[model samples]
Every structure is written in C-alpha cells, then in structure tokens.
Target: MIEKINLNNILFLDIETVPEYKNYRGLDLETQQLWEQKTQYQRKDEVSAEDFYERAGIWAEFGKIITISVGYFINKADIRNFRVTSFWGEEKKILQDFTNLLNTHFNGAQHILCGHNAKEFDIPFIARRMIINEIALPDKLNLFGKKPWEVPHLDTLELWKFGDYKHFTSLKLLTKVLGIPSPKDDIDGSEVAHVYYVENDIDRIITYCEKDVIAVAQIFLKLRREDLLIEDEIIHV
Candidate 1:
C-alpha cells in the first residue's frame, strides 16, 4: 500500500537540535552531580531532568540546527532530488521559513512525513521548539492530539522493526544490515554539537544531515523492492 502512495507525497526530513540555555555549561561537574541525584526521581526508562538539561546545554553551545536536509521523489518522474535548507538565524525565523516553504510548496497535498526516529525526537523537538518560539505549526504536524496509528508518519526506524517490537535497530546499523552505506562513518549525532560549536563548519553538518537523508531514502527503496510492494525499478540514487 505504501507504493500505491505517491513518492512525491512524502517529505523526508531530518533536524539538528540543541538546548536553549547557556549558563549550564560552566558548571559541568556540578551539573553532572546534580543529574545523578535527579535520575533517582525519574521513571526507569525516562531521561532525568538533569540529563535533559545537560543535552540542552550541549545543544545551546552548538549552533542549533544549522541545516535541515530534505529528499523527495517527484511523481511521474523517476529521479529523486535532494535539498538542504538552513535555519541560520534566530530559531523563530528558521521555523517560520520552514513552515512557509511547507505551506507554499506542499499545501493541500496528502503527504507522509518520513524521518529516522522522528516520531520520538526530530518531530517532537521541532514542534516543541516552534511552540516555544510562537511559530505556527503546519496542519500535518498538529498530530499531538491524534492517535498514534492515525498520523501520516513514517519513521524508517519504526519500519525496520519488522513487526518485532523488541528488536531495536539504530539507523546506522540498519543501513549496514541492508547493505547500504552507514552515514555515521563521516559524522555522528554525538559529534554534531562539537562540529558546529568548535569548528563553526556548517558544511560538515549539512553534509552529515544529507548523508542520513540519503541513507533513509536508500532503505525505503530497499523495502519497496524486496517487500514486493513496489515495482522492481532501479533506484536512481
């Protein structure tokens, strides 16, 4: 059924995030100690407040979301074109630009929003930040009140689950298992903050995001082909 859906109707997106506060960095030792103390109060699998604060701190230190890489396969066309867009200024302005593009380019079209671990991270992170910045969210992103299965969300990570809920797979590992190149070889999520902060190299961040988007697209192709849901056509990567 996924193949019956037009490829152009899907938006493959990836985001880079950081924290909103700055002063927390100078107190790393104290912060870590406080985080350890706070972990006891959190649910077993949930992130502790201190841990979240630390991650936010790291994100703040690193210029947040230097770019968002998008990939889409146009309908009636055999080729896929990728675009890398940046949120280079204030967070609100960046979100506004992204929203404007989505509305102007993708409005009134039935589309599936695809991303890697997006349901848990990228989507929520962007939405929450947008809300914080008072940016209007697109209709497609207003799925917070909807039931899980009701949303037009396609997380490649979730698809990789293959009906087994307990089998956890990272995007990097999934790509490797599917014989696709691992994008993590060049840059990883952990180093993204450092790359943006220390080096101030936006190209590396953009490249890394682009690599992940490409990897996800490859995986989607593999699924469509091997699962017999789509035509056995060569993917024009």
Candidate 2:
C-alpha cells in the first residue's frame, strides 16, 4: 500500500506537549483536586499527584501542545527536498495554523497524515485539542463514519507491526532498531514539560519536534523501500 502512494501526498508531523501550567502548583484548587483524583489509580501510592504531574501531557485534558512541526516532500531538479514548517506557542494559534495548513494544502483524498504512532497518540491528541479549542476538525483529522481504509492517516509503528497488536514500540527505539538517525539527541519526551515550564526554552522544543517530524518522514520512506533523504535535502519553511 505504501508503494502505491505518492511520496509527496503525505504530510508528516510531530508534536511537543506540556502540562497546561508550569507546575502542579500552577493549577487551580478544584482542577488540582480533579487531577489528583484522576491519577490516583495510576499513581498507586508510589508517587504523589504533584510528582506525576510531569506526565500530564499524555492526557489531552491536562496538557496543551507546545509545537507542531510538519513536513512534506517535493522534487526540485530531481532532488527531493523535505520542507518543514511549525505552528507553536499558544495552543489556539497552533491549532489555527495547523487547521489552515490542512484546509489549504492537504485537504483531499490523495493527501494523508503520517507520523510514528500518530493514529494512537499524535492524531487523537490533535483532534481532542481542536475540540477543546473550539476549532472545526479538518477533513483529514475527522474520522466520523469513515471506514478503516478511508482514514487518511498512516502510523509508522503500526505499519512496522503488520497486525501484531500486542507489541508496543517507541519512536526512539524504532529509529534505533531500523538504523535511522536519532531525534532525541538533545532531549527526549520526558524532559519536554520541564524544558518548557522551568527552562522556558520553546525554541529547543521546536527543534526537537522538527527532528522527530523529519525522522517520521524518513521512517516512512524506509518502510516504502526508498532511499533516505540527506540533510541537504531538507528545506525549512
């Protein structure tokens, strides 16, 4: 199926997320109580809710996207250049900008959204955030009444599994196992919330997110049995 699809038809993406507030103390009293209650089972007396707050980004309700970096391939003089752009900072702006990109460029049956584990995490997170921000779901992201084949999304991890539903793979691990370049050279997902909230370095997060997007694109190419694109082949948008 990947072999039949046009390389340029895929819009590859990655997202960086953080807790809605800087720290657990930043949450309001009622919301803090709710967060505590929601995480009780998972915390299991092993950690306090405040300690577990670092992982709030995994939940759409308690977190917000910090950056969404997306890339697409285009041929220029027989050289394929992967162009990337980012929508970042405020969640509303990020969603709005991403929405505009989908509506303007990738809103078609021929276009697809692809990422590592995106179908399970990134895509769903984006959809939930869109609803929370009151933005209309872009056609590609909306799955209402659509059959499985009709879903315009591809997950690299899922493709690698080839129907092995019991296995779980992380992007970092998959990239290493497949001999792809590491996207986590600077910082991994675990440090994102701290980097954003305490260090106040959003540019770092954007860079990390962009690398992940590029890695996703590369992994997709590898899955299609295509040669990898080099650094010179990347064009920043």
Candidate 3:
C-alpha cells in the first residue's frame, strides 16, 4: 500500500507546541486546580503540578501550537523538489493558515498528510486546537465519520512498527537507524517551551520544525526504497 501512494500526494508535516501560559502561576486559580487534577496520574508522587506544567503542551486542553511546518513534493521536468513552509505566530492564526493550506491545495482524495507519530500527536493536536479556536475543520483534518481505512493520513512511526503495537520509535532514533540526517542537531521537543518562553527564539524553533518536516519526508522516501532528497532539492518558502 505504501508503494502505491505517489510521493507527490503526501504533505509531510511537523508541529511545535508550548503551554498556554508561560508558568503555572499564569493560570487562574480554577485552571490551576484543573491542571492539577488533569495530570494527577502522569505526575504521580514524583513532582508537583507546577513542576509538571512544562509538559502540558502535550495535552491539547493546556497547550497551543506555535509552529506547523509542512512540506510537499513537486515534480517538474522529471526534477523532484521538496518545498517546506511554516505557519506560526498567534495560535489561532497559525491554525487558520494551516487549515487554509489543506482546504485549498491538499484537500483532494489523492492528497495525504504524513508525519512521524503524527497520527497520535500532531494531527490530533491540530484538530483539537482548531476546535478550541472555533475554526472549522478542513476536509483533510476532519475525521468525524470517516472509516479507519478512509482516513487520508500516514504515520512513519506506525509504518515502522510493522504490526508490533508495543514498538515505539522517535523520529530522531528512526532517522539514525535508517541513516537519514538527524533533525535534533540544535534543540528538541523538551527544550521548545524554554526556547519559546525564556530564550525568545521563535526563529530557531521554526528552523527546527522545518528540519523535522524534511526528516519526515526523507524517512518516507527511505521507506519507499527511493533515493533520499538532496540538500539542493530542499527549499524553504
């Protein structure tokens, strides 16, 4: 099935998210209590809610997407180029711009959205954030009544699992094993919140997010037994 899908039909993507507030104290009393209750199990007895707040971005109710980088293949004159772009800044605007991209270009039945572990994280995060922002779901992201096989999504991590449901692999690890360029040269998911809140470096984060998109695309190419994208073939727009 993977071999049947055209590379041009896949929109490779990655997202960076941070907590809704910079600090746990930033939340009102009611929300603070809610956060405590929400993460009770995850935090357990190891850490306080304030200490655990940094991970809140993993949950849609407590976080917002800062950047969503998407890449697609374009073949002209038998030359293939992978173009990557990012939607960022205010959460709502970021989501709206991403939704516009899907609704406009990749909404066709042949188009698909792909990422590493995105079926579990990026896709659902974007959808929940869109709903929170009151933005209508684009056909590509809307799974309201779609059957399992009807969903136009691909997950590199799931593909790598090969029916071993208990198996899990990070994009960085997968890239290393598969010999693709690593996307974690600078910062990683654990540091994104600090970079956004303390370092005030969104540009760096955007670069990181775009690299992840490129890595995801490259990984997909590897899985298809195709040649990896050359540096010259990757364009930022």
Candidate 4:
C-alpha cells in the first residue's frame, strides 16, 4: 500500500476481456439485435453493429473476462516485494476462483481493491460480468449501500485526475508519464481481441494482464511519492 494504506490490505488487479462470442456471427440473431440496440450511441452510421462487435469486450453486456490478475505487497528490509497471481481460462471458473480468493484472504473492512480507471471501468465491469455469470458479488466488488468514504476502491486514474472529471488517462499512459515501466512490452489492449480469437493464446493475455497489475501497483507508489521497486522485488506467484 501507499501512504497510510496497509500494504497487505490493498489488492492491485487488472482484467483481460474478449467478446462473449468470437465474432458477430457466433451471436444468436436475437442477441445481435439486442447488442445493436445497446450500442446506438457508440456505433457510427457507416459502421454496423456487427462491425463494432469486436469492441463489445469494453462493455459489460457484450464481453467476458479472460483473466483477472492480482498483486499484493510483501515488505522486507526496506524493500517492498510484489507477488502476483492470475486466474484465467473459463470465465465462470475465473470468477468463482477470484471471488473465493477475495472472500478468503482480502475480505475485511480495511481491505481495498485498487486498479487504474477501476471506479468507472474495471470494478463495474467485474460486477456486471459477475451478474451475467450468476456469481454473487464479493464484498469488495459490491458498493450498494456504502457511503463515499466507506467505498474501498482506489483508482490510479482518479488519483491522477485530482477531481478533474474531464481528465481521463489510460493505465499505459499513466505508467509512462509517472516514470513507471510500461506494461505493454508484449501486446497492448488493441491486439488483445485478435490474440484471443485468432491466436487462441490465453497465456499471452495473462502475461499482459499481470504486467498491468504490476504497473498499477507501481503507479500507486509513485503517486505517494515513494521510491519504485527494483526488478528483483517483482515476483510472480
């Protein structure tokens, strides 16, 4: 954790997603119609919903999570070591396993779930997917009755915004500007759909996802005016 936050109490997470179906044709006609109706604001007059279907993963209704990578801190001798774990493969199994981990280890009033752009995107996307998958929302993901001060979600993007609602920054951009190492060394989000649908490689996406988790954690440290961790301190679990 950065600042007053407990190191172990903060769980840094990032998700990788793809359209629920590989392509537009894979969706049933009724579902396609619904998708078209849902994207009326975003779809251009020249672009049919089918042409825009690949982008559905960005929206909760049309996409499924492929991976959820999380990281936490392990402080040792003035150095903070980060160990990350990932859940991928079947979306339902991933949601179940992630929820179990949250329930077992990070379920506390003090615990927080931190991500870049999480408040508007990741957290809500996860909740929406959990609903679509028929999984119960874990305590950290559910904010139904919590006051603003009680909400434990921390967003690096929001922190960077500093109450500037018009400001929107991507994780990659934040890491770069904040002097944290870029997480897109292998593949970026733009290529994720192609890599998942055409290459059919979940491992690649996992790697990218894990890198984002690490990047988010590092960005948090930077925001707190703390020193960055060396390469040896980053560990994979």
- Per-model C-alpha RMSD: 5.6, 1.2, 0.8, 1.4
Q: Over the stretch 1-237, how does candidate 4's per-residue lDDT look in tens digits?
A: 348887778899999888999999999999999999999889889999999998989988889999999999988677678999999989999999999999999998888999988888888999999998999999988889989989988988888998899989888788878888899989998889999999988889999999999999888888888888778988998
Q: For residues 68-161, could you state the per-residue lDDT of candidate 2 as single tens digits? A: 9999999756778899989997899999999999999999879999998899889999999999999999999889999998999999989999
Candidate 1 per-residue lDDT, tens place, 80-151, comes to: 444434445566777888788678776554877888888887777777767767778897788868887768
What lDDT would candidate 2 get against the real structure? 0.91
How accurate locally is residue 184 in candidate 1, as Cα lDDT from 0 to 100? 90
Question: What is the TM-score of each predicted model, taking all chains together?
Answer: 0.77, 0.96, 0.98, 0.96
**lDDT for residue 115 in candidate 1, whole number 0-100:** 88
Best by TM-score: 3
Clashing residue pairs in candidate 3 (N, C-alpha, C atoms within 3 angstroms)? none
Superposed Cα RMSD, model 4: 1.4
What's each prediction's clash count?
Answer: 4, 0, 0, 1
- Please tell me which predicted candidate would have the highest lDDT against the true structure: 3
Report the lDDT tens digits of candidate 3 across residue range 1-237: 798888888999999999999999999999999999999998869799999999999999999899999999997888999999999999999999998899889999999999999999999999999999999999998999999999999999999999999999999999999999999999999999999999999999999999999999999989889999999999999
Q: Please list the C-alpha lDDT of all candidates, in the order they appear.
A: 0.67, 0.91, 0.95, 0.90
Ranking by TM-score: 3, 2, 4, 1
Clashing pairs in 1: 18-59, 19-56, 19-59, 19-60
What are the clashing pairs of model 2? none
